[model samples]
Target: METLEGAELCFPQLLNTSCRKPLQHHAETIFLYILLSCISLLTVVLNLLVIISISHFRQLHTSTNLLLLSLAVADFLVGLLLMPLQILLIGGCWFLESFMCGLFYYASFILTSASVGNMVLISVDRYVAICDPLCYPTKVTQKRVQISICLCWVCSVLYNGVILNAFLKHPDRYNTCYGECVVVIGFITGAVDVILTFIGPIAVIILLYMKVFVVAVSQARAMRSHIAAVTLQGSVSVTAKKSERKAARTLGVVVVMFLICFCPYFYPSLVGQDMSTSVAFSIFGVWLLYCNSCLNPVIYAFFYPWFRKSIKLIVTLQILQPDSCYAHIL
Candidate 1:
């Protein structure tokens, strides 16, 4: 009986202090690990493709694609780092040191926050492109977009640093036993994080996209009404309008998916409860949010012809040819 009990402890030698292993069946454990490992690998490969396509193809370099590139980088790290650690967590033990646990969560928060910022930036980009096409070129230049991306990342790092300061300083503060890692946020702090990281950004995204939708619909109606009277200049204007409307629709789907994946994760904070990683719902929420990173690249592949074209070039080794960067992707 003693030996059996010891076998169930995460650290058998430290029986009194160690956490008991979670009661999972052997086959169930193996299946979960395999499934999650495949997802992590898929997320990494897909996001890496997005990163390569945008960075290598000269024609793919636009203000909007730059924002996507930033998002892909964040998602890529999620798959490469966070997903693996999360897989370890499914075994119900923290094999690494306390400091590493803190670093893992800190990096997770930074990547998550940066993703929110990038979505907001994408919504704003589509808004301007659709609503005020005449001034979009001057207003949303590549230099300005680059500056905004930099600010987005810097602010995410600083904001999450402040939010997780206490946890970082003492990663084992809330642990119940050895082999466990957890973080608990006080109610006030959790509420503030929800507002800053979730609510405020979500509001901005929905509002901007709402305006984009209205304007796009109106423009479509006007173009259809006057289709017969289109001169060469009018035809060019109509074509540009069609392009903007299509972009708005595609990005609208992305924003909606972001909201769906993120809302449940923030529900506890929204309800004025303290956020704790030890809860079952929190674990489910975190995985759902991480799954969004994988989904984004799939969405791009479905909607963007340029991404498909670039994938073919990349897979066929055509990208290794001289001046392949100049290949027509758009």
Candidate 2:
């Protein structure tokens, strides 16, 4: 009986203090590792392409592209740091020191919250472009967008630091045994986080997008029914509205995808439970959230011609040529 019990222990030498290793078939373990590794690699590579594409090509340096760049940075970190660390923890043993554990959660919170903030910013950008086309240029300039992105990241770090303060101060305060790393927020704090990170942002995004859609439809109708005196001016007006509509459609797809990925992650909190990292469903939810990072670049590849063009230039090393930054991508 003692030997059998020891077999289940993650660290047999520790006897009474060691956490039990989770039971899983060897084949299942290997498959999870392979799948997660592929996801991590794909996410990193694709988001990296996005970063390079926007950073290298001056033509893509618009207000909207700056928001995409910020989102890509957050997604890139998920792939580079969070996903790999999560894969390690999937084995049900955390070998890292306590300080590393705190740092990991802190970074995860910052990135994830920052991604939400970027989405909100993207929604607002689309709203202004579609609903107030004439004012969009002055309202959403590159310098203003950069300042907003900086504030989004700063606010995310500070907000999450407060949410995770107790855990950060004593990383192992709730640990029952060695080989286990878990962070749990109190019910009240979890509820607040759900509201701040999930509910409030989602509400803002949906509301703004809805407004953009209504205004876009109205503009489309007006474009169809109106007759202008000058042919060239009418053509230019139609072209601008069409561009705005297309941008709205593409960004709508992104927001819908974001909702689908994030809802499952916040389900436990919605159901009135404290957020925990150890439960099986919690782990699955976390991975689902991470999977969104992998999907965003794919969405861009499908919808944006500029992304495809930039990717081609990058892969063929055309971006390395002199004055490639001025390459006409759009």
Q: How close to the true structure is residue 302 of candidate 1, measured as C-alpha lDDT? A: 95
Q: What is the C-alpha RMSD of each candidate to the true structure, in Å?
A: 2.3, 2.2
lDDT of 2 at 138: 84
Clashes of 2: 0
Question: Compared with the true structure, what per-residue lDDT tens digits does model 1 show for residues 1-330?
Answer: 445464688788886789877778899789978988998999999999999999999999999999999999999999999999998888888999999999999999999999999999999999999877778888999999999999999999999999999999999999999999898899989988998999999999999998998988888887778743556543446678898898889888888898999988888899988787753663589888999999999999999999999999999999999999999887
Q: Residue by residue across 282-327, what tens digits does model 2's lDDT show? A: 4679998999999999999999999999999999999999999999
Q: Which stretches of candidate 2 lie above 4 Å from their native place?
A: 1-4, 226-236
Give me the displacement of residue 236 in model 2, in angstroms: 5.9
Model 2 / residue 317 / CA error / Å: 0.7
Predict model 1's lDDT versus the native.
Answer: 0.90
Error of 2 at 116 (Å): 0.7
